[model samples]
Target: MTILYMLLSSLEITDISEQELELIEPLESKFPIDKIKVTVCCQSSFICFRFYVLSSRYKWMTYKEAATARTAIGCGLIHHGILKGSCIALYFINRPEWLIVDHACAVYSLISVPLYDTLGPDAVKYIINHADLKAVFCMPLTLNSLLSILSEIPSLRLIVVVGGMENEVPLLPSSTSVQVVTYSQLLSQGRSNLHPFCQPKPDDVATVCYTSGTTGTPKGVVLTHGNLIANASGFTISVKFNLSDVYISNLPLAHIFERFDHISLAHFGVAVGFYQGDTMKLIDDFADKETPSKGVFCKSNFKHVCRAEYI
Candidate 1:
């Protein structure tokens, strides 16, 4: 079966009427109605894999699982007093957990500051310090480099590791005062002590992305929740991806192009698969017979694959 067929047939999702789908604001009004579907996608026996994290395969998450994770991360943030409008850094690559934390941030109405995983220590330090980030949801790849400049970023207090355990926490400088917590632990705390979801205003800043600092200091670009919704809505109407569409998300989420597409695809409830890091293996993933019609590939790789008809 095709990836789109697998998603629609196996999962139970309420179809958003055309009227409701056209609504400009994603989270509308003072008391937001829960019309937005959290039950986007889930694991089924049909699909081979949902997320290829490096070489490992992770099954898809159901709506309930996604909601639970949302509550868990939101509650964990709240418990630590990371309230609405607070700035936090999402320093990781393209992974399933990245999207979970993103949804959780939206739940709490917290501002997200996305950092490239491959950023240099100076760039990392500059962004953290400039944003005055107090918390960060990161992975080992970025965390290791971040730790080197942790002392310089005094505003940062919490390091929520997305994939690693507390035991695996690296040693910090004696002067650095930062608390490390595992992602699962945060989810546990959130699950037990669920907090009320905060409604975000259209103008509320959803994320702050930094530009590549080729010349000097990186420039920060602020995008509001409304901006994101508008872009996603536009993309949906323009691209029109359906349930049967299977998409491969392999580009860096830190970039606006990739990030916007991911958010847009989620709104459409299309199945998205994350690519494993190796470009050599990427051909194998897309070349598979079951690979669907739709996929977002990197611009850099476009030239090489332009001759291939499957793309």
Candidate 2:
């Protein structure tokens, strides 16, 4: 009778294999998205791989592609001597390239400092100087704004502009040692010279987010990879997410709230669509009188998911 009782207590309630357990373990790690499913929409710009989600408007990037880009970009940064713990600034609006740069920063253990799109030159100058940024990624328009203060930021040695060729970049001052290149060029260079990913400790700082500077001088909020994972994991407890969810990111990714929002979506293999930097334009694109969609429910679902806890 005692043996029978012991056997009953020892019996496993759930039958999960080691392989399944291994897949689930990443959920607790600082990089949960590394293990999640990879899915891309039919209109994806890249070749079809196993995709976990789909997009209606722009091409969707699968987790696999993101991982590849992360490694490739990390390699490029290494060639430029932007080693781990170096500060890299992202000065673009919410776009696919932003995600690629963010993940690449994580892959190489580089600290990402995001600049607000609406921020004036003075704010940009302060944050870049304060963080001692070594490199910067910006859109062509944002690059124009940075040009005015590029000479002031002595630590900045590299400027990679998105959506523009090198010849198109505005001439820089002779005194500034900054070398300008395009985003694709960097990716191509990196893919040609691949490198191993950096393994960051749980306490390693991931990003330095600055406040809006409404009250005083904008202060930098340093966040560790574990802190971000904790924030994303907390949201997972309240509302469950799956691969089917599509997130429309209208908020500035510079904000900690929006940064965690993307991390949470990545955890669930959810697709994200960036608003075209304009709210009214987004409304027209979604509700265009001529274009038909899968339905309004998909769009409404995005709102529901985004409205969840931000912290």
TM-scores for all candidates? Answer: 0.76, 0.75
Model 1, span 1-311: residue lDDT tens: 11111122224435533432222132222322222232344431112222333433334354435545665787798888788888988887766667677777776788878888777888989998899998998886667776777768889888998778678987665666787788988888776776666667667788898987877899999998767766655555557655556666667788888888766566556555666665677776666564434322221211111101221
- What global local distance difference test value does model 1 have? 0.63
- Give the winner by TM-score: 1
Q: CA lDDT of 264 in candidate 2?
A: 64
Model 2 weakest 10-residue run by lDDT: 1-10
Report residue 304 deviation for candidate 1 (angstroms): 21
**Candidate 1 regions off by >4 Å?**
1-58, 170-177, 288-311
Worst 10 residues of 1 by lDDT: 299-308
Off by over 4 Å in 2: 1-59, 170-175, 288-311
Clash count (model 1, backbone only): 1
